[model samples]
Target chain A: MALLHRRLERSYSARSQGPLAAHARTLAVDAAERLGRLQPGNDFSAPLMVAVAVDLAQANAGATARELLERTLRLEPDCEPALLALGFSLERAAEHQQAAATYGRLVELRPDHHEGRLRLALNLIRTGRRPEGEAGLRGLLGAGTPTWVATLAAQELVRLLIAEERLEDAGEAARAALLRTPGDQRQWILLASILHSQGRRPEVLEALRALPAASRGVAPRARYSEWPDLGAAASQSRLGELARGAESRLAAALVEIGR
Target chain B: MTVARCVPLLALALAAAAPAAGADIWVTITAPREGEYAIGEVEIAAEVVARAEVAEVEFALDGRVVGTLVQPPYRLRVDLGGQSIAHRLAVTARDAEGGQATAEVSTLPPPIAADFEVELRQLYVSVSRDGERVLDLNGADFTITDEGVEQPLVTFARGDIPFTAVLLIDASGSMFGDKIRAATAGAATFIAGMKALDQAQVLVFSDQLLVRTPITDAKEILAAGLGGTEARGGTALTDSLFVALQLLEERQGRRVVILLSDGIDTHSVVDMEQASALARTSSALVYWIRFARDADNPFDDGGVTMTSAWRSSQEYGRQIELLTRAVRESGGEIIPIRRADEIAPVFLRILDELRSQYVLGYYPDDRRGDGRWHRVRVKVDAPGAEARAPRGYVDD
Candidate 1:
């Protein structure tokens, strides 16, 4: 359909700033007009409408886009792209629970969808279902998922394990993620922080220095404000407190070393 | 007679045992599946299975009743704070017929504690006096502030640091013939100027993007990628820049995007606002190269005329303005070329400035990583000398 082509072009343009972005915007406006003539339940019209809504969402009209996407899903629940877009929009609006539910349903509908599973796992963690979330991430890695997905899952697993004071497990998970994307500075920091917690100051310094010098200075854009304490989960475990203590000690060390 | 009596007795016993229907009810705890929770509002979801009409569901933590729900999807939110220890989470479902079922789960909740952390912010500073770069400025010669509060410089490194750059060339229909060739040559010149540790990727965009070369320091690879590129299709400069930003997001060291385009946005889904947003937030410096052939002479021959392209519409002017703003916000420079030969020199000049610029790192005086934008101003001790640094950063 003309609407479909225009929508696709508009998607491309929205990501690009070249001449095509303006052209795509104009074409999408025209396509939106023609879209009304098409009947609902035409198999393609629902997606087209969803596409129009996506274009609007890119323009910062997320609420309008969310309504349109919901309407389209009301008619056809199997629209994958629309469902994904809706989940992302919900996330942008800080509706984490709704986004998690949406992604949960998406994973249920398409059991083998990597992106859906990834989003579902992350949202579950966000909603404080750490065990289920960790299981989902582990499952993805064990199922031979894409490298990027596996990398992301491993990274999240490290954070979850660290929050539980499972230092050895966190180190293992961090190492796995690092092997996949050595360029990710956050993973390096996670590893370094873990080492610092075990009284292994030399190992912590080694881990920090192992990272590319340029990336060593960088940190994740977001972090958990609190660190978990040792033996928090198990009564007989030998862990101390969360990684924050180590982070403080390390910060002082860094300042002392003056890199 | 004895056999018939025994069969009747067995049937009566079975009937008595199965006397009631629709009398069972059960509840199950769905969240905190690992029996552990992070320190925060923990959402407890419970599902009820009942053969009879359900009256209500009661939620409890550590044997104390917290709240009751009379809905299909029984749920409750409990603030689990004060200590990092294990507690019992329980739920009970009661049927209208007085039958009840209970489920309990033990979970270790995270302790509420504060993390003393610092984030090191990197700023690439360029100092110029009368259009020439000044590279000898030391850390003492520069003063930096965030939101008007002075920050101490903790890390300072300059020159010989590895750089990562992306050569974004426009191969749109309007840039046919000599323009594409000159752009390719200019790109090759830029790559040749890089140090052994530096890497660059070449991306040519028309309506779609083509990877001329992956990120590499090898000269042969750079040549093979930039060579044999032709102009076709519509321009998608914004898309290419967005892609460039994404590619450089996680890379280490100085990130730069050398964008060579005619300043005309034709066919891109991304508008100026989005581009500007990325530009404002990106750690990468964007150098926009706008090529025009003799704006003063429209009747000249023997070369492609880019002056006509700029003079054709107001849209062109707007596009140029957008690019200029992006450059300024990114603390980068925009060079307008009047001849094809100027392209190579401009590329070299950018490389020179990049190599000679100063790097400053400091932790914000305001250590609260509350995700707020803090404006940064870098000042040089030299009088009449202007310094360019990142305008601001979002603390996280």
Candidate 2:
């Protein structure tokens, strides 16, 4: 029993010591026993049980995981770890609205938590609150925010702008991304495509010329399709067809320029 | 071991104690994740962690024993018909040696699916006299006819009643710059003007449909939703209209769709006919707010002088005729604005009209679900009063 408890405590934050089925069950039973003996109002019991639930849940025992988390929440509704795990579980189960609400609660409980806000924003966008989602993403990119979050925000912002057909803004965003990561073929292709969409043939040629010789051949296909918010009905058939036509358009333009 | 490590190990040994006599079993209710579920048969499954051989598992709801399984795969299904509210679900696992473990989960009722029966068909009727709403009227002062047959009014309510509205805004490329800003402001003004109980959703459509906000009464959230929308991509006017109607169909009370667009249909999977059919069938009223760049009086001849073939063939003529037909049939109106700033005023006027209107609902005497279009007519009894209502509905 002492060895099992020691293993559980040591494996709590270790990536290599992923919870095995037998070990997770043992840990869960041990945690449940400890929770049963602890004073009803003790603060440590809830987190201890939540950790055991997370471990069991990671071991393919989601039902056990959920039950444990729910039990902890019943005692301490503001338990951050339990709420975060439950929200993640609900999200994986495709219960987006419920998951979004859970994450929203997490945001309220821990207003300064970056991951909570990021997850809430994602769930909001997934459930069709585009404005709030976009605003939250932008908020996460503001000054003093984490660099990782800012990088992700920049990608999502550019994707959203391109989706809205704001090519001028998209071009600017793509150029900005290029400045951040110079010689990136992806940004060059995006800049060229945005110029093409705007019917600026000369600028498109200039963008193409700027790309490294090895990177220049086929124009980076503009994927203005795949609107996830629109659900499964948003097919990429039209965009795919347009991309195929673009390949030929680029070929012809290259011949005309004698490149 | 060092003294520090030895002290921690001693504390760990004190914390780990084996239970006396019978082994402790950890019981967990797994299925039916802690959330809401509508009234239906629910299957409850449980997991029992035990060192000893498990004997039986009992499933109960609200303290009543639902079922018990002696073998593995302990699961039970309970009909949750009468349980419309929150209830506690519990599962108890008992070993052969008499040791027992229990787990309980509480659940609330989920949102009812959209297919629920439409009990009352609420209509938002705007009665006007020379471009002004005549708000003072009783239930008996109005008459409703479905397919030319008079419908007995079961219920009647006047304005300030809760209404569910979908603000279908066009963020297409053509509606760039000032147009998008105007539409956003117009939508925000409309949302602000809604009654306390009123709810509105913002749906921005270009080639893609982006739901800015689901049904909500919070002005800040709705404003943020609208403000974040950027105008780009081709217009999918018909597709958006269809989606708006579909969304409003599931809502209760007075249902309305405030469609703000430039009256152009492009890049839509559905056509105007399908969209028109949907609007004709749905009880929700649709108001079209079209933006015109110039003073175009081509359809000023009351649509009588224009031939049917001409109306169908000419692009501008066809769009005008479609809008007129849609508005007239839905018992709504088409408000055309020449300037972006005028949109806020137009929205305010529409909001006023919404507040002054009456809702009338009646069950049809005819119950043949033959799926056919039924033309409707609404008349006002008071002097100098005119009633605007949906032109027809499909019996399905």
Candidate 3:
């Protein structure tokens, strides 16, 4: 009788475990389905969808990837990842504003996300937000960022500032960036630009001439060669002609150095 | 005074009996500017006595001989159509060398008629943050407010509508490396996406504008130009856009311009404000694609090393924003694409939006030629329908 009772208990325990496992699987599927249904079309709904999709996709229920993406967006429109995903999707779908908003949300959420930040910066550029977008990038670089991200961000920022005729700020930013990463060829070019804008002809020439030889950490040699050092001669001459007295003399000296 | 009056009446009676008449010469030159005139049509009229012997009259423009007419008190009209702008008109009459007299006439400036019309043809699409092919509605979506009242949309249509497109490429020296590749590719993609019947032109500008191909088959011209792109001059984006707008002005259908550049107007003769005005008046949509290098580093020296990139990117951002504003004001959108690979899909999406549009045309009751800009209003009477159309049209 005792043995029969033990056997019955064991059988019941095994049956109970089977149902519990099934329930867990069912819960996962349900979560995935909920996520998949959340397709948020706008900035407000993109992030939520992304987060849920990430969660579901991570769980090995690969089939729920789309569903997970959809549901989270349906719940919270402004979720960041969801926004990024939605932005990416919309971009793929050729919906620019919706995508821009998603990227903008990503920028708001993770300012340090370089990819997100870069994308937002680019979008802002496309939309004509020059100073603000550049300032954002400069702020990031000023925070002592590392390696390639810093290099790329600094290079782009300097070029834009120079183009916009913000010489003083460009000079300061370029100098600061150069101090941190001296091997950056773009920074050197930027320094030359600042000096040129400031009418420091000799300094500009020196800066260009002082550019280190193609080496580790410096910009590619091919890029450096494309700088048009000799091509700037006409502009330098024009600057010299425009300057009077000491300024002209200084410009001449710079021209000589450039030569 | 009474005697004088009687004498005048006597002379008038004698003149009436004889019906005596004299010749008067008048010349009219219908050119836009005094310094510049096309070699088109010039009208000259001379009133003369029935039996008067008017020797010869000579017409000249800018010291060069245009034509000569030898007839009594007669009207002569010269057609100088199809001539470029930069000519003048001077008329001289020579009954004899000693009796020769010359009359010079300066042409009036270009007319600013209120009845000017501009249409938005194609809207370029680009990928946004959410990975969707969307139109950038910055400067393009303008609200028409007449006397502080909002107007309604009269017509709206997508890609199915016939429109003119201009592709402006940057041949600036700074657009080197991957940018040149991407721009060419983007342009090719845009051309590929156009409908067979659609017309598009490709213009590459740096210090000057160069029209690589006129509005024709997108596939053939695009393929020929896309692979041979060379970057070697200062940026003149503003000037390029202005030229594109001018070209689009004569077009009957919708007009749009797609600009590919790094957003640096280094050597543009025209400023942003002027460009903006031209864009607004012409109602041309401007789509700017900014090419930026990827950021692989996140931290170094308080992020100072990234300043150059940041500033350039930001300037590009501002230019785009301004362009967006321009487009939106004209009921168009600004599309921004980051990845070069995104160009094709974005172009396709723009084409799709254009195709999906529903065009609604209506004739208003007010048809007075008042020589004024009139506001147009279009509204969706349906409960949930949306509408879009030109904010206004000029009525003359």
What are the C-alpha RMSDs, in order, of all predicted structures?
A: 35.7, 34.9, 24.3
Best by lDDT: 1
Q: What is the interface RMSD of each candidate, in Å?
A: 18.5, 19.4, 13.9
Supply every candidate's count of residue pairs whose N, Cα or C atoms clash at under 3 angstroms.
Answer: 27, 3, 131
Residue B133 accuracy (lDDT) in model 2: 85
lDDT of 3 by residue, B79-133 (tens): 3322223444565655432244455555532332335332212222222334433
Candidate 2 on A169-200: residue-level lDDT in tens? 87787777677655544355456556645758
Cα error, candidate 3, residue A161 (Å): 28
Best by DockQ: 3
- Global lDDT for candidate 2? 0.64
> What C-alpha lDDT do the candidate models reach, one value each?
0.67, 0.64, 0.51
Query: A172 in model 2: Cα distance from truth in Å?
Result: 40
Ranking by lDDT: 1, 2, 3
TM-score, chain A, candidate 3: 0.48
- Give the worst 10-residue stretch by lDDT in candidate 3 chain A: A221-230
Candidate 2 error regions (>4 Å) = A1-259, B1-122, B293-320
Q: lDDT per residue, candidate 1, A1-259, as tens digits?
A: 2343454565676677646754664565444335434544443445455656666676767798898778667766776766777776676565668878988888888999886787788778877888889999898776468665675577678868877889899888888777767876446656766765565756755664454422221122211101111122331121122124444675788899996
Worst 10 residues of 2 chain B by lDDT: B304-313
Show the colliding residue pairs in model 2. B329-B391, B331-B389, B331-B390
